[model samples]
Target chain A: MATTTVRLPRVLEPAVGAVREVTVSGATVQEALADLCAQHPTLTVRLFDEAGELRRHVLCIHNAQATRLTQPEPLADGDELAILPAVSGGSGDGRFEHRR
Target chain B: MTTLAVGTDKGAWLLHSDDQRSWAVDGPLFPGWGVTAFGRAADGTYLAATGSGWFGPGVHRSPDLHAWDQVAAGPAFGDSGPRLEQIWTFTTSLDGRVFCGVAEAGVFVSDDHGVTWEPLRAFNGHPTRAAWQPGAGGMCAHRVLLDGDRMWVAASAIGVFRSDDAGATFVPRNDGVEGAVPDGEPGIGYCVHAVVADPANADVIWRQDHKGVYRTDDGGDSWERIERGLPAGFGFPIARDDASGALFVVPLAADENRVPVDGRFAAWRSLDGGDSWSVAGKGWPDEPTYTSVLRGAIATDGDGGVYLGSTGGELWATADAGDTWQRLPGRYPRIATVALV
Candidate 1:
């Protein structure tokens, strides 16, 4: 398995000891997330939905490019996967604006 | 010292008071997350239900309210088609079973403290499931009341449902109530904001509905309007003081406005089982204050304390059964739920 680094958003730090990133081993994007969740189990619900699918608002970036969680793109030793909130539009007024 | 756990759209705060007048504020714990509800498990573990627009929902457990750790397996709807949006309320049975009412309108139970959860299929998959519609708050099973083997769940724009056989089956309990959506199924469109059962008699319950404030003596089989002192019956929360058998509700202008009547914020209290109501005691602001309290934002400490949090992020407390009111300091995000710990 290739060793990779998984970066989490600040809002999710509490679930993983307040760390910004973690090192995991996996062969693909999904496998790497599985490894990350295995290490920090609480992150599972935050990143994925009950159907085991990546949540609609969560985005996975691989090597500075947006990618799907189920993409089987092979991971290299230095590969980096970043979890970030998907930028979306909502109510223009801040009152009901969607969370970033 | 009496501590109040305030859950808001941003996080959670703990307000401590030694004499019910002066207070100390503790947090915005779980910063940036929407803390929806708070509950103490039968084992006394503090559970906070948190939701994120981007990351979905989660539950955190704490030995005390100070430090919390997220549960690995929280309440979820796995492969059930409907998305598990947010956990609205958590209710624990006398026998240690924990039940969670979640948005997307469903119920889940956990027998092992708050560690794991399983959905009650009978209630979740009712025959009226497809007809269930959401109010402006979105369809959510926001309230759950348990009376031994009988239980009630109130969902928005879907009225109330009762399970007489310990949640094995459920029946719609919206007779004599006006339907929010007129053209929908016969007994399915009544919008129920909140429900509080009489402490001494579970069969006697009070409800703050989209139509008006109502009370029922024969469980939920029938209801009668009970809005004497309330200016307008459009509001979100209805809380009952167990010790005094008093009921409380904050009436709003209308469903369209959703603010306090005439911009004056005051909670109406009923001492004689909701037969009539009056402005609950003094200390309300002299100026016009326009704010709304969500269904779960009002809570009573089994003794005589009643606390209310508003959508504007203000906190108010009444220490002597509404005889006197005080606005607690600190302005955070929109307050969602308040609980006395």
Candidate 2:
């Protein structure tokens, strides 16, 4: 069993209502994510693409360095992984709606 | 509901849209930096380039498309080399590699998502880095459109460059292009504003230069001028829809204005690739109000949505390939880059 810590941002910390950390397992990154999404069903659609595949845009980091989903990269015990979204240049006009 | 991640002067905003065009927004993330560029990866995540007005630049990411975090930060104006900097453009390849086009500097790639980065040394190392001159907006690496494994980047005065090895090295792609000759030479200046490869074809490509619109069927080896239907081919931005192979361009009515009829917006649509075109002003702005769309700011959402963000902070989107238009509310924060998220 591999144990890793996942972190959420402030905006999402609220949407998810409360900040909660969960554990997941598997040899591949996808397998680990599958377990995580299973525990936090709210993250299923955002964590994968239309085909339900994992992409780097989701920015899954294993132990500080980025992880390759295709490789047989294994997670270490007590290691930490981050599931981050790709942030691009954007702005908020006091006029439009702001969700998160 | 997919949110349209709009980068503007004030900050980063999310224009979220449901099935009925009922759009909502989230965040002006990084409150200070005016967002300049951003791209949502196939995995449905978003990456943003926060413009730090006078402070600096930084890159942020959100895996869930909602929450964002600053993974990396850039420099300020007097900071490209000696000072901090700003990221002019940000995009991700279908394969998920992140590329950021910076000012004064060149392209930077972050292979491990956006946690850390390595400058596209090949671009920053271009022999002409120092010699290359910035246009009206500074030497911002404009567009980094990825076609297959190859990548294309635009540098003002440095022209357009192609890297088949994925940002490793770059070579010029400016043959047969004309217009930006400084009123003398037959060649267009190295100031390329935007470039896009036909989503359906690897060989065909198009770019917007300071002088004229260009096309290349030989990867980036050679190009041809396609200025027959434009008031000025010396426009700044270009866009395309991968589904219909339909291309759309907004040429500034005047060489200097780049803001046709005084910012009265007009969209030029090319049907048979770039071989032919027709103008559509149904949803565009009217002239005399006087303004222009920014470089790399015109694009389609892949599902028939075409949008352009202007320096005026206006954002307009059309659902039917320019057939009709709808006005969204409000305006952009700063108006550097706009993308469908």
Candidate 3:
């Protein structure tokens, strides 16, 4: 069994938990996320949308290589995954703006 | 039985008060999720429409408002259709059919009281899909009103639509409303921010749109400008006092800046329907305040209480029909909607 470390950004830590890192076993990136979701069920909703797709604002990087929840790459033992929110300059122009 | 459900970007809260003065706040249900809208069923079941930056939209049903069970069946699209982005409104008809309006502009119904949802294909696959483009908030069907066999649905940037045979077929009803459309744009579809049907007269409907305030007396067959007494033309959250036929609206400055006019917070109210309006700002902050109220952030309890939630995370309540207001206790995430029960 391969053990991987998953780290959530500080902004999202409050939504899931204060703990930044969690370890899960998997041979591939998808397997690691499935195991991570099983260990922390609440994180599933925080990390993915209802369609089980990664939220639009969420970006995940695996072992320093950016990976999408829609298309995950394989993982290796001791690999690290980091999750962060997409950056944007919000506006109050009252013109319709995309939020999500 | 005076209860308020405040749906926020972070979670959902239930505020209860017996005399409309002291309130007891409960929960951050589905913590860290955005609760876009919620409603109470006839059998006292509370259904919350929630989504998040990491997760998409889903419905959570609560029997006692204390414990919630996420429903297995939620809004979904077929393999090739646009996905359901967010659940913008949850409503129950007199006949007990629960209806949910979602982004990508579609309606869904649950005859089993939120247990399962099926798309109202007539509205979803309407022939006007090509011309109905999304507004700033995306193509969302946010408001649903039912009167007998007649129903009204509001889709942003697409104007108002009416269905006489109960969601089977629909036709556009934007005869006199205005949109932010560019010059020479064909069709009359406009951005409708919020809409409320008259409790006493189903045919009388008031709307707060992207450009102005309007009223339709002929059940949306046509509409007329009703901003004669409003301070500004752009704002969200239009609610009505059911018992007295009084209407309320929060007016922001303009399309360029979506804050209250002059940086002051106030709610404009009309006693005799929409003939005229008066500003109500008593008990609000005197200092400069810059915040906008979203489409569903305002609600009336029908007795006398008027409640509004601001994007600034403040909850304001008026006990005597907007004559005076009081800021509620806590600081919450941006509020999406407030429901009074």
Candidate 4:
């Protein structure tokens, strides 16, 4: 089993013990995320969209390499994955911003 | 103990004030996330619905209103259907059940004091949803008014929906409400910004629509335009103090321009159930203003304690209906919603 360290965005710190670094075990990026979600169950809903797919705005970085939720490359032992959300404006104070 | 809970784009804060003149603030709890809605459960559990651009949406539960624990299994739309974007408003029923209105226009109920939630499928699967177009605020179920088995839900760009069987099934009740969409027309596409139900008489309901203000005496089966004594019609937030039978509304310029009416900031109130209105503008700044108060930003605590948060990040409190106002210290992120806990 490959042991990887995951980096989550600062915004997610409160849900995941306020830790910037989390050690997870997995051989692939998907597996690492599964382990990470297992460790922090509440993080599952935030990380995945309703289709059980990674949200379009979230970025999953694997050892300095960008990866998509649909297709994740293999991860090696001691790999570092960064999970962060795409930068965007606030959800509009309930007005002004157009909703999809 | 009157504690003002402010939900902002960045996080949530608690302002504890004994005299309503001075406040001791606490917060920024979910630091990087947006706090869309807040409420205190019937059991005294404080709940804040938070959403992150990166992490999605969840509920933060607190027993003492200070320290909170994020609950992961709050509400979800399975792996299909419309995505649950944000938790727009939270309503705690008289019996302690918590109901949360969410973006994508749906309702979820939590029996365990917001620890977990399940969708009200009947309302979500209503036939009108096919024609439910999103307003500028997205297709959000922003307001849920409950009175025993009868429940009413208001969504932006959608008219009021009523559920007589305890939210099991809902039917559109937009008889007198006007629609803003072209071919989309009336019924489902009518833009309703906010709604408040009379605590003394559940049959009486009021709405702040994109076009004008309306009141329904027969429980939303029909409505009557009640724009008397108002500067302009377009407004976002409308609330009422059940104890005193006083109604509150904030009128804006118009749909084309949503700033305060004529650059003045004031809340229009009606003591005799929307028959007429008077400006409750004491203690408010007379300077030209351009701020907008969102639908969920205005809340009434007990008899006449009115608390409002503006898009400009200012918190205003009025202890005596709107006779006078006091501004809370410090400016924070854009305010989305407010509640008295």
Q: How do all the candidates rank in terms of TM-score, highest first?
A: 1, 4, 3, 2
- Lowest lDDT sum, 10 consecutive residues, model 4 chain B, at B178-187
lDDT of 4 by residue, A1-100 (tens): 7888998877676677667888998878899999999988877887777788877667888877667867756778877899876654334332223442
Candidate 4 reaches a DockQ of 0.52
Return the lDDT, model 2, position B246: 72
Say which prediction, candidate 1 or candidate 4, comes out ahead on lDDT. Answer: 1
Q: Where is the poorest 10-residue window by lDDT in model 4 chain A?
A: A91-100
Q: Model 1's DockQ? A: 0.45
Summed backbone clashes in each candidate are 0, 54, 5, 2
Q: Which portions of model 3 show Cα errors greater than 4 Å? A: A1-54, A57-66, A69-100, B183-188
Best model per lDDT: 1
Higher-scoring candidate on lDDT, 1 or 3:
1
TM-score of 1: 0.95
The digit string of per-residue lDDT tens for model 2 on B80-198 reads 35222356777778777777777654677766677667677787777655556555555667677788768778766567777788666787777766534365323325667778887
Question: Compared with the true structure, what per-residue lDDT tens digits does model 1 show for residues B1-341?
Answer: 99899988777899999998999999879887778899989999999988877777778888989788888988777775687887889999999999999888899999988999889888889899998877777788888999999999998879899999999999999898888997889779998999999867999989999999999999999999998877898888999888888889999999888888778898989998888989999998889999888888999986789999988899999988888899999997888889987
TM-score for all predictions?
A: 0.95, 0.71, 0.84, 0.95
lDDT tens string, model 4, B211-327?
A: 799999999999989988998888899998776777888888987888887788878889888989988758777788788888888889867799888878998888888777888
What ranking of all candidate models by DockQ puts the best one first?
4, 1, 3, 2
Candidate 3 TM-score restricted to chain A: 0.78
Pairs in steric clash, model 3: A48-B55, A49-B55, A49-B56, A50-B56, A96-B136
List ranges where model 1 is wrong by over 4 Å.
Answer: A87-100
DockQ of each: 0.45, 0.02, 0.20, 0.52
CA lDDT of every candidate = 0.85, 0.64, 0.79, 0.82
DockQ of 3: 0.20
CAPRI verdict (incorrect, acceptable, medium, high) for model 3: incorrect
lDDT of 3 at B80: 72
